[model samples]
Target chain A: MNISDFQTRFGFEAMYDGYVDAEVLGGYTSDLLSDVMSKAGEASTLVTIQAHKNTVAVATLVGINSIIICNSRPVSAEMIESAKAEGIALFRTDKTQFEVSGLLYCALRDAKA
Target chain B: MDIPINTEGGSRVILELIYSLKVRDVMTRKLVTASADTGMREVQQLMRDNGITGIPIVERTRLLGIVSIGDLLKALDQGQMAEPAASHMSASVVTLEEEMPLTFAISYLNRYEFRRFPVLDKTGSLAGIITASDIIKTLLVEMNREVERLEATIAHPQTIDPAASPGLDPGSAGTPEEIVLSLSFPTRQYDFDGAGKASAEFKKALKQLGIEASIVRRAAIASYELELNQVIHSTGGVMEYILRGGRITIVARDQGPGIADVQAALTEGFSTANNWIRSLGFGAGLGLPNAKRSGDDFSIDSAPGRGTTVCVTLNYAAGP
Candidate 1:
């Protein structure tokens, strides 16, 4: 899945312009950045309430090409810069974290099944 | 002034005007002036002769008031042309400093609805008068210079940065000369928000260095795990990514409230992570085992209270 597909499925504002073409593998939800770093390794798209710069860092470190930030959290300018630098695609949504995580999990499961 | 610059070139010009252009550079030096005792009709005649809309009413060097076309029209309609120019002019005037940025003048003009503002020097003497037109014309000149510079650069491209080094040339493979890239990053405590940034940057640098894809992936995962461990488990640390022709090495040295049992920490499903960490989809006790999985060699050294250090190394063949 591409970032635009996620944008179409759930209304998400694409933060970094260049990385919008990043691929989505599956989804992992986390608020603590290290948690995602340890568990979300390669290909899994991350969903979280954390919209800070380090979230982008964790996603990039774990080899995740894209991330979805829930709860309408404001993406700071520094976060955008870091995401662009790390080449990690960033998405923001107004929906709560649990809702997005569940929906993404079901969607990924269905895709896998 | 809300000058709607639609073109890309125009936007560049506006940016230059904001940063480098000053009010004195754009203001009209040949200013039309009036005295307080001058008749409103005479002031209007002076404005008509000069084909200008505003004039500063001054006594010697001190600015007394400013008469605008709007004020003159009001006076003419009220049959007050015979009255003194100061009587018809606005005494509360907004002024700009000659040395101030043109952008500031534009914003000031925008803040209060005014046709023009008086430009003053450091000594509080009137230097000139500036309007929106004057500012735009100056911006156009600056834009032209920028366009010329860009054209020159495009015509003759130059390599500007000194530190950029390209990776291995693809033509040869059997060369024995070794190339190594070294990098270091400092990690902070509980900076859960910033946990793995260093690993991410290291991964990118590895990719740029044209390291083997499998090795880069392994190094990234290992470094990330170690970095997160530092943030969650250790107090703080320094992470170093060392890339040689045949291997990738990650050394993590951290200050800590050290672990009591190294074997338990490395075991699968044994964790010291709190509930908060678990709720965020981690603390599954997988970091250590996973870190070990990603590299061919992993070693850990720790005591209960002092500190801990972990080093992971993956040996790879660097072939063109």
Candidate 2:
């Protein structure tokens, strides 16, 4: 998906000055800890609502491009800076984890279709 | 008439020249360090507070093993009720000597999948520690610094647009025509593993120079897309940067199953990637378009079964 589509669908404004020119290669949405571990890489953008430092570390290890910190719980300042220094874009949504995952599923399904 | 093959642009010449680019030149010379005896609680807290996943366990310039947030997580799994750090920390250290070049550092770091490596002094003590993040910082600085100097020259008419009219600061404002900033990386056939290293390193060079945020993002996104293409499609390829006037140009060429339709391939949603590639989070067909959009000028040359080459030039106007 294009950056504009993401902005409209997710209702998010760029946190930094210049907007992120990201391409959705595909979408991976899951809360299952192990599931994420077995999949995901530095290239793939991850969608999750789990608000914990562990999530950041996991994303870093697998080299995820971006982490959609879902649930609108307000991303931690530390996580934000970590993502910045690492050049991994972090996106947060007011939508619950389940709702966001559903959206992601639909998005991916449409793309594949 | 015979077309003369010259060494002016030979691959061997390029590789030999780039091989000399050292790690300390690209590695974060001033890395964050910590004492080996740091407590587990403090270490974990530090990692969280600093937004860093790893820290170099050092002692007055002595290198010890490194600890990552993952290590701490494993420790937590074992037991998290106020345990001693000695129980959790791994002393099997991987290190790089301060004199060691950045090229060697990149190889070792990529092989070990290490986020940070402690730099040893002449005595094998921790002189400092470098992390993957440090590399990112350095690359970004290179791009940022270049843009700023360009912008500065624009702002001050007499300053001589650094790239076009230099002789002001060779180290910073040197003539762009003479400044050749290049980056190299290992490539494999459809090997998704460690593919982002080149782009990451390229971005680090930009970031380290303290380049403007806008230019950094431009070069980073463009470089990243090119790097991903190399890993996903090409047998291997290299990314090179050249500066002239106020334009910074990037060239990405790779040997692989070349595209049959360059224009169609440039579309937003035309992908020929497989399921495995898709699962890894790429192959959606946005790489080409994304690269095009990120830069002011873009071009692509390819053949059905030969290879593909992409070139992008970003023009920065002098800041008034």
Candidate 3:
């Protein structure tokens, strides 16, 4: 599934739309940046409540292509600017990280099938 | 030429060399001294014969003062060439200790206007003299030796057939060609704004080198964790990335205060960060472990009063 599909299918609002719309290989749900840095796979979507600039920095370093700030966690302007600069798709959802991760996993698995 | 002993941006090997080498190691031990009452004309003759710009005026190995070519010129202009060297020599000279680190000599050279400093031994007797040119010459020789040692350590690429490694991309299967890339980034303590920039750059460079994605990912993870560790805990530090001979080595060095306990610090979930830092999605105590797990070889050295140094080496080929 492409990064833009999250906004269209899950009704998540797009915070930054200047991304490459690359295919999302999978998803990692973590609020800890170290955990995300150590375990997050490349080209994955990050589902977390970390709505700050550092989160985008970690996403860029680890090759995470998309980020979904769950629970409507008030993403900062700097976060939006960083996401745009790094070409990472930024989305915000009213659902929790658990819900977003489940939905993303099923979607990615079904796409593989 | 100003020798920039840039601790924050210079190569670690050069920095270590300057810190490890003593002033006596590079100073010229051959003494060409004259008595305090020696005639200025004789001093001038000594300077000309030895091709030296300055000569230390001594009394039986006890340094009293130094007379430069400028002083001789002044004496000759004043028709006082026959005067004693003591009359024209500059006293109150700034001197360096023989046991002092080369870095001190470098700073002394920059701090003072003197072309050279007379090195004093433990008994306060003049032992040798050091100049900026001497430091530069020694550094060039040492750096050449270090480069040769590094080249000697370059391992031959493995001959694993691409077919044997399932799912290996043919484009990245062959041994990576010899390429040298060296980068340094200065990281400040609690500088959340600049954190991870080094690792991001490393990732980009590896991708451009056409390294396999998995290897690049591992290198990126190790670098990121190490960089973040410096930002969160150290006063300030530098991150160095060197890619050569199909291996990537990331070295992070910081200024004090260092870790108190190495074993405890490496344990999972052991963190010294306060509540505020923990709130920033860091300080979970996985930084070192994560770095170690991602790298093919890892070593960390830290002490309470001194700074910390972490080195992680990643190979291009996947480990067995």
Candidate 4:
């Protein structure tokens, strides 16, 4: 599934759409940036409530192509700017991190099938 | 002359200098002395001729007492100008060892009413004398030198070429490659907005250098964790990145209320961050451990009063 698919399929609001629309192979759910940095897979969509610039930085470092800011956590303009600069797709949702993670898991599994 | 510097709360450089410098470093070695039989009138002459406020009464380098200008004045007023130096000289004196740290001298100056202290060598011989003025002068000179060094570093930032670096054998590399990148960024305390800037810059530079993606990820993780540690834990500090010899070295140095227990700090799930800091999706106690896990080599040096310095080295050849 491509990064744009997360916005269209799951109805996640795209905060920054300047990214490359790369393939999202999987997903990792965590609020802790360090945990995400160490464990998140390559080209994964990060499902977390951490809507900040540091989150974008961590995603860039760990090869996370897209971030889904769950729980409607307020995404700062700086975060959107950073995401745009780093070419990482940013999205927001009213769903919690667990709900987003579950939905991403089902969607990724069905896409792989 | 009471030195107005607060020994406990002074800047890290000053505090480190004070603690590192010995009493002998700041003491006046040129001695002017009077014997027990030296007349009070002669003491007065010595004080006038040499422009000295005090003179130690010594016998073959053994310190006995000191005669000050005040004692000479008392002798002149009481018709005792002809009396021996020992009779009026203050016998009980507080002395400092030549090897004692400069902080001892500073504390002694604050504790004692005397203007100077006689510095003694290991053999119990009078080596020198230290006054407040001497300490002040030395510290000022050293601080000036330190400032100049910092300015020079700022003027010409280091971008080291691996070929020119000494002690690195060129034959060790499979192919002669020129690796050049050294950068430093200053990090402030609680500056969450600017916390990961250094790591982002490091990632960009590493990517530009054509380093392997997995290795770059490790380096980025290590630098980010260490950077965030400084922002959350230290007063402020600098994060330095050096890429040379097929290796990336990240150093985080801080002016600190240093870690009291470094072993516990390295353990996962041990954080000293406040509640609000934890609310920002940090303070998970995984910072140091994650940094350690990412790097090929890790070392941390810290103490309660001294600042903390953490160095992480990642080899480009090392697998993720």
Candidate 5:
């Protein structure tokens, strides 16, 4: 399923309130930039809370589908602005990291089914 | 809670505090090396004797390439096993420098689907070689060290200032889960041959941040599936993550046609994916469901004309 389908099915509120017309890739969750760089392949979705620009550089290098900040944490304005500038779909979640990952896994499974 | 302690600690005491650690701290410095001219029979014997799967093929200490058991066997397929090692060895060797941080090394190994790699010097000389087994050993050693340090700390909890502790320092033997970190990235759809790049990036990030192997694998699989989903289902999308408080979460969003039926899509055998998707070794209808099974929690929201969003969470439970 696509990002819009995820929002509607899981009742996720858009972080930026803007229309993002991207397709759903896959998910990655790790804080290690080297690992992300070498492993997170191109055009795949990533799930990470590391908001550094280095993250953006790696994402740009590997070319992810979007980014999701979990753990009920808030994305810095600078990060959000940068994401927009880079044309990345930035999001935030009130759910705990566990909750967000679990929900996404289920949805992806549901879609696969 | 103060107590007297000795320099040496008990194993149980150490193991209790060192569980769930990573392999970045104790990677072997003694990297094995070999020559490209080495015969396949000799290489096979060396591997069997040393219990190794790979070796860096060097020329006058310069890293020319590498040879693995698989490479040797592949040569055998063409009746070339009797030939020189250079003729059968992999030409484009993936390598790492000795000075590179362990995180980078781990990421390189995990991301490339390679079981072993050569380490090179500035002059292109072979320094050593690292393998998946070596990394695993490193992790084990680090865990042991952490356990020892933790036992010492616990034995004299009052003498050490908790506030002054270097949280999650691998060299200092701190707990693995003590680190607080965050990461982000963008997804692009440049071409078909370039697909799976985003997920690869995400895996690299995790390796750099020092996540465990199992965790990285789960994340990689999920990301790869989503990337293939993008190539098969839509024009493109993005995937991102966050790591904190003993859990990692993954999110994928895209501007593609939404799923028609959430229930039908969630099933195992059903697939709207085309034959092209299957041709690429995906679209077996296992991507989404496999991701859900691998994660602690999974959720998705999509509309018929709107885009799609996916979220996945991985919880590294405390006190495991």
Candidate 6:
């Protein structure tokens, strides 16, 4: 599904501008940068409470189609610059990482599984 | 590069070379010495023959004083050429440790008008001497190599980073087929603000290079895990990435207080992550296990006080 679909289904703010329509094949969630780096699969939508600039870089590096900054964390200006530079689809939500990850998992379960 | 004076960390290469350089690396180890009782005429002849300005006056292994050309001139003018070297030598001295870093020596040189620094060994005996000219000579050689490297980089613009090719075989690749990406990022413990920046930039660059999305994801995820692991478990560390032909390998090396057990740490849930870390959603012991699982091959070599090095290799050619 497109990030717009995910945004529409859950009230999430699209935070950065980059031409990204990457397909979401799966989803992974973690607040620890290490865990997410190791476990997050390809084309996955990464949902996490990490809203720092490094988050955008990780999302771009891991090929995460979209980044969901959970817990309403503030996305800094540096993060937005990296998001735009990396062509990553950026989003933010008031939900927890667990809740957002669950939603994305459920959304892709039938299609990916 | 001309680094802005206000910039933090300064120019990386300048700082790296300056700090990495040691006094032992540049100090003149072949020292010429004289006994305090040596005849003034003999010492003057030794200095004239060697073209040296001064000779350190010694008593066995202990440094007593220094006799310079001026001391010799004074002795000759006063008709004291028959006197011992100590009679005209300056007794006070400033010295530098043989093991001192070049930076400290540089600071000492700047703070004093001393023509040279007497280097002492661990036994407090004179080992060598360093002059300002020695440092300039060392810097000239270093700066020349840098210039050559920059020229080579300018000669070929397609390589990722010219400095990145330090370890590459001169004949490794003449074409783009074997073109690889080599980079390293330093990470600090408890530096949450900078935690994932390295992997993120790595991921973006890989994607731009046209690596398949799935492959980039796996490699990036693994990179992130290693970076975070350094921040959480070790002292300060660096995440090294080498993207070679179809394979991505990351080596996580750190300064330690290293791991006592590699096996126990790899267990699915046996984490040393403190309670505070747990609340932040890490230290679950899943970081290493997950990193290993993501790699086509993974191995960790670690020892106490020696630090840890975790190598993760992901072959993009292999199915994800």
- Please give the DockQ score of every candidate, comma-separated: 0.33, 0.08, 0.55, 0.52, 0.02, 0.30
Candidate ordering by lDDT (highest first)? 4, 3, 1, 6, 2, 5
lDDT score, candidate 6: 0.75
Tens digits of per-residue lDDT, candidate 1, B185-260, equal: 8775555545677887888888887877767887888888888888667656788776666778788877777889
- Deviation of model 1 at B140, angstroms: 53
Tens digits of per-residue lDDT for model 5, A1-40: 6766546776655556564657665666765443454456
lDDT of 3 by residue, B1-320 (tens): 56777633467667667766778999999989999999999999999999999999999879999998888999999999999999999998998878666777887777678888998886789999998899999989988998887776665445677643323234643556543677888776655666888888888988887889888888988998999898778867888887767788888888878999998988999998755567789999999999999999999999988989898998885233
Which residue pairs clash within candidate 4? none
Backbone steric clashes in candidate 3, count: 0
lDDT of 6 by residue, B22-63 (tens): 677888987788998999999998888887888989887788
Decoy 1 TM-score against native: 0.51
- The number of the candidate with the highest lDDT is 4
Note the Cα lDDT for every prediction shown.
0.77, 0.62, 0.85, 0.86, 0.61, 0.75
**DockQ value for model 6:** 0.30
A27: Cα error in model 5, Å: 32
The reply for model 5, stretches above 4 Å from the true place, is A1-113, B1-34, B159-320
Off by over 4 Å in 6: A6-9, A16-26, A29-35, A95-113, B1-181, B201-213, B243-248, B275-281, B315-320
Model 3 chain A is weakest, by summed lDDT over 10 consecutive residues, at A16-25
Kindly list the per-residue Cα lDDT of model 2 for residues A1-113, writing each as its tens digit.
64444567777544443435566666567553224534554356677765544355445444556677666766766567656766666777777667766776687678779
Off by over 4 Å in 1: A15-19, A23-25, A29-35, A38-44, A71-78, A94-113, B1-179, B191-194, B273-284
Least accurate 10 contiguous residues by lDDT in model 3 chain B: B164-173
Evaluated at residue B274, the lDDT of candidate 6 is: 58
Q: Considering every candidate listed, which one attains the maximal DockQ?
A: 3
**Ranking 2 against 6 by TM-score, winner:** 6
Worst 10 residues of 6 chain B by lDDT: B1-10
Candidate 3 per-residue lDDT over residues A22-61, each given as its tens digit: 8999889999999998878889999999888889988987
Best by TM-score: 4
